[model samples]
Target: MHSILPLLGATSLAGASVLQQALINPTNQVLFGSYDSKPLVSSEALEAQITEKNLRKRAEDLFSIAQEGVEEYNHPTRLTLCHTGHLATINYIYATIAELDDYYEISNQTFDAVVGNVFEYRLVLGDRQPDSVLAMSLTPPTPDKEAVFGPLVLVANDGCNESDFPATIKGAIALIKRGVCGFGDKSALAGKAGAIAAVVYNNENGSVSGTLGTPSKYHVASFGISNEDAQPLIKKLEAGDVIPSSAYMDAIVQKTGTTNIMAQTKGGDQENCVMLGGHSDSVAEGPGINDDGTGSLTLLEVATHLADYKVNNCVRFAWWAGEEEGLLGSDYYVSQLSKEENLKIRLFMDYDMMASPNYAYQVYNATDAANPVGSEELRNLYTNYYEAHGQNWTYIPFDGRSDYDAFIKNGIPGGGIATGAEGVKSENEVAMFGGKAGEWYDHCYHQLCDDLDNLAYDAWVMNTKLVAHSVATYAVSFKGFPKRTDVKMNDVSEPSIYHGPKLIM
Candidate 1:
């Protein structure tokens, strides 16, 4: 009996004997002896060979949170209205939210409450200040626009380069803009520039987020403006328009109102762990049973089922709170992993809206897509399962927009499942699946009606099975499955060569 060191805590004793029996019975001398020499490996060693040691125990804990609806990854909460971001239900991308109130022209009294900014109230060109305040005439239009006002003021230092300020003071505001770096960097720089209330704007325009997506890291109220709006302000600068034009950026916007329910599974070495996650929250208008509930619940059920499976690897089953808000929960988690924790991640498997009338097993960065870091082995395991079960799948590249974004950027392999959402069904898909053409795979995508009624139970079950197999397969599979880093479709899980019904893209 050859001895093998155990890594993932599980051994081949469970079902390994069956494969061994089939191999050594010697009943079919010709077929059984493919191995010329005697097989010296023990069944326990075989089992141990399949177990993965990189998983965390929080899988069960996080899953329970989702099952109880306590950890809504996409909904607003006390922490973020919906853990979408540290901002409010809505926030400025690279800037801060704008606010104002309307008043009766004759009464000269504040009438309407505040709305959004140019970052939030960009839509409102008309003044909404209190009629009383507007009618007062600002004491003959105050000779200096730079006069420090007690109520709403856009304050800043004379220079734009220095970021040296002390926190000893409070109340005064700070003025900032894009350029010297990112939105978050601007906030820190401005804070150092000495101003409690911080207001920032874009340095240039076009699509401010660079083709990749928005950058992570935020500290204070940030605002984003279009080139049209920003350029005009800059033009004013060229013409010495340094006087405060408006006070929209002067208001306060808070995402601290949102809540992020984080459930984790402790492991031997949680410093770095694999994250299997899905969004647990829903859109404000919908219950969201399929757009993501399918994925969330699938992961939840798998975690629950595997609760007692003493995995050697730290396996963390997570439910994000701000997915609908553009992967906020996941992004937060990734950002917070310690440098050591970041390195421990084996891979990140994400399940978002994984069930639909028709399911196609897709991989991130498959055909011509791009992602930060992906696993070929895991990708192969998924595609291989479909092929093994007599299913065909397509490999495609996907923007790392899901919770797995931070992980991938930090060099963690990322992949996920998505039956379909927010897109029209292609003719091939419609013809293959027999669903109505010109319709979205998920008719209830983000609507209030996206409850269990809109779900296809069969599809949900299939996705669950796939996820189950994926998690189980990883927990106990030989070769430790495969990783899907590059778009090597044929490298690990090559399209099945078996003759079977063709699967349409």
Candidate 2:
């Protein structure tokens, strides 16, 4: 029988650890069994029970259930936000967590929203599979048809014209595209061109449901399209089916969303606290399963395990909202914290997208800087844990993207690990990690498919490993904040709360 071999080998020979005792006496297997009551702790089951691999499987399963119960689709035909779909996604997440046997316990549900920057328009090209976003951003100068009849032709719209189109007439409405400036530019140009109406296409991937720039003076009606739908129209104009009269083009830039959920452990090291956080919110439009229902669920699962752990330092768990809103929630919380309060804080640990579908694990502490006197030490701790586990790794920078940004900004040692997201998974990555090459690190990163049906079991195994490695490493290493001036960086001074005490029951 195997338990977590005595994590501590103290000076006294008589001070045999409970874990060591259990490991030495095979008969203890009967007392400390698994969730299923199996006497023999199979190496595979150990991987699933107390290891990172097991945690990730549980996390992904919850994500799958949330995905199925939510509406992740983005439709150009229908544009909305903070609506039924958004609430549905929240409901799904709550329901999934509620159903998990006991690994997750409901803590609290606080809801709020950020000022979303962009509008998401989904245009389904069932038969008209437009190659680019420009192709599908079709528009007419007016709402009415030609005197007798006419096929829809894209109207040109120069900024000078009220409409960006050549002319806003009876049959033809103004056909405007998002370009050269604000949505107002296309609309203003279309209005000057005499367009009765218009449609624009966004050059980006996510959403732009909200207005860009500001209040508009333009009179013509308009909407934006994604790049996937806009490219075909470019071809049509080149082929003479439509004319690119008054054209506009530029990448659509706007706000997405994020959520930050935080709560202190009922018990633990309070004076020297270790903070665990990950963004629960994604690209507003996505289920954000890997981007990161995985991280969020991992923390929630760990939270359930906390009530069983008693120790020295206070542990605080927070799920950040508005991470997509440029780390807003965390920033606000940190900003509002009394300076003295900030200093009581110990290390900050973040787990973001740890289970990449492609699963190429490249982690970072503090990105290079001449002053490199920051989160680098914290980074070493996490990576060191992996090394102790006989794992190899790479490190990247702590690019203030997630909720930890607020902590780092206030001079806190912020460290985090990520599997991969949105970035391309290289051919070399496939060679090393063995997932499909050339695919985005998270195929479902901000897509509606970031649900249970899309995750790989092995990927789940990998995600949980990193998360558990980070959490467990931080847990036993709870000597309080490392001596701020102590040069023994990455050195484990004391055991974390998880190693404190255990109830055989």
The number of the candidate with the highest TM-score is 2
In order, the Cα lDDT scores of the candidates are 0.41, 0.47
Q: What tens digits encode model 1's per-residue C-alpha lDDT throughout 1-505?
A: 0121121211111112111222112132322222223233222322222211111112222222222222443432212233322221112100100110100001001111111111121111112222111100001111122223211223233224443333422333344443434344444454454433333443444323211013222233333334444444445444644333232232222343232333333322343344587765555445565656666656644543343233344555666655654565666666666655555666678888765654444555532123333365567667776677665566554455467655656666677767776556767766545567788777777665565456566555555666766655444423443433332232222221111000000
> TM-score for model 1?
0.49
Tell me the lDDT of model 1 at 285: 44
| Model 2 bad stretches (over 4 Å) | 1-112, 115-260, 365-374, 476-505
| Deviation in Å, model 1, residue 374 alpha carbon | 5.2
Give me the overall lDDT of model 1. 0.41
List residue ranges in candidate 1 displaced over 4 A.
Answer: 1-253, 257-273, 357-361, 366-374, 477-505
